[model samples]
Target: MLDPSVAAVRRAVRVALSRVAEGGTALVALSGGADSLALAAATAFEARKRGIRVASVTVDHGLQTGSAAVAARAADQARALGIDDAEVVRVEVTGAGGPEAAARDARYAALRAAAAARGAAAVLLGHTLDDQAETVLLGLARGAGGTSLAGMPPSRDDGGVAWARPLLGVRRAVTHAACAAQGLEPWHDPHNAEDRFSRVRVRERVLPVLEAELGPGIAEALARTAEQLREDAEAFAEMIDETIEDIVEPAEAGIAVSVAALAANPVALRHRVIRYVVDSEFGVALTRAQTLEVARLVTDWSGQGPIDLPGCTAARRGALIVFTARA
Candidate 1:
């Protein structure tokens, strides 16, 4: 008896595969979690039905005590799902940041390398609606503006490979149900239960309160908001590109945008233009304070001095705001 959730997940996988170019292989990133295992199973099933080859790759971050065993378990699960080409790649996570984030970065790096090596066109992840909701809440806690609030996208391109989250609309509970129906036991990562992690805190503490106060649909609402914001951001980016064609000019230090044109545009578009400038010239994102300061210089100060920013400086030069790094 096939679970309805499993059927729905298979449908989602088929839809996701349809978006990619035909006859290209897909690599599923399996992490032994219920969400990722379900994704791997669904992808394998759908790929077989569509006559597309699918490979499952698990990254062992070597952070946990028994990570290698866990990776092996994930590979076995993939093999059980008729994925004959399941492989486990080992990665060493380093840096001063949290171990969880470092592991995640290393894990993705491994996945990308595996996909490239296998000539895969896309890498499928299992981030679900619950993860999206948690991300939105974390962004709100930091008050990081619309971009942060947008959370994760269903599909994106990174390092010349398409990354697709096929289960973004599905709940975590559905994935668990699917695993149970398939008679598979997913490994539980202890880090997920630790309150030291902000996501765990949000999942266990904050989200429960929000659900009790605001109702059970809070996660759905946040995920929907994120999707809408992602679409709006994409459209805004296209507008910014068109606007840049007329206002942006190459300079010795960096790029310069006409202040008059920037001021004339709507405030929302103006912010996007500024962000584009900073990202293009400095290769860094402006903090909220830095963005506001730049806006003030462009709108209020007609001929004021330069304002120093991270990795670059913004100054008003002859009706044009020039952003360049200090020499």
Candidate 2:
């Protein structure tokens, strides 16, 4: 009999595999961690049943000693689990935005290249429900808006490559159980235990404390919140697309929105539109305070001068609020 944990992960992989074209390839981003090891094994089993080819790529960030060997072992495990095509790609992690962010950027770039070279329909990630919970908590701590709090999407397309997270709805513990049941040895990254990383701290300390104080299901609740917020964000995105086309027009150096049209919508929608305009046009995100200041142009027209935003300026010119690039 198949272990319940293994069955659960297989079910998820089956659903994610449905997105791939018939007999198409799917690449698994394996890290040798319990979550990713379980994901690779499940994807291998499910892909075989569906006549789909499965490949695995283990990225070595070269951040720690023996990282290459760890990656090679992960790839070997993938092969042992019925994934004949397993490869290890070593990436140099360099960039701004801290070590964690830089490593992530490099890893993703490698994955994108690997996926394109493999002609895989989708690249599977192993981010579990606990990871989503941590992401939501981090967003909340940063006071980010709904977009940030929405957490990671289950699936998204980037540069013609589809990225899928089959385990986002599954618990991390289940992955461990599944790996144990399958007699698979997973490499626990030492970085995951270091308190210097915010995510590690959140996983080791914050979540446990929250569970103790607020009951047993805080992680599940946080994941649920992220899911709900993502739904809301999708709905809002549709509404914005519909409303923006009618009220927005090209301006001298940027874009302009009809003051009357913006004023007619509810305050929530109004703020969203204001933020959306600046973000879509100027490629800069607006803070809540900045958004409200722009909204004041319509609500409180007191002959104020142009307000400078991150990459643009907003001012009420006649009957429209013009957002122009800063000279």
The best candidate by lDDT is 2
lDDT of 2 by residue, 1-327 (tens): 999999999999999999887789999999999999999999998888888989999999998999989999999899899999999999998999898899999999998888899898999999999999999999999999998999999999987677999999999999999999999999999989999988899999999999999999998899899999999999988999998999999999999999999999989889999999998999999999999999999999999999999999999999999999998
Q: Can you write out model 1's per-residue Cα lDDT over 180-293, one digit (the tens) per residue?
A: 988889999898999988999999999999999988899999999998998898899888877788999987688888989999999988988898889877898988788888
What would the TM-score be for candidate 2 when compared with the true structure?
Answer: 0.97
Alpha-carbon runs more than 4 Å astray in model 2: none
Mark the 10 consecutive residues where model 1 has the least summed lDDT. 15-24
Clash pairs (backbone) in predicted model 1: none
TM-scores, all models, native as reference: 0.96, 0.97
What do the candidate models score in CA lDDT, each in turn?
A: 0.89, 0.94
Per-residue lDDT of 153 in model 1 = 88
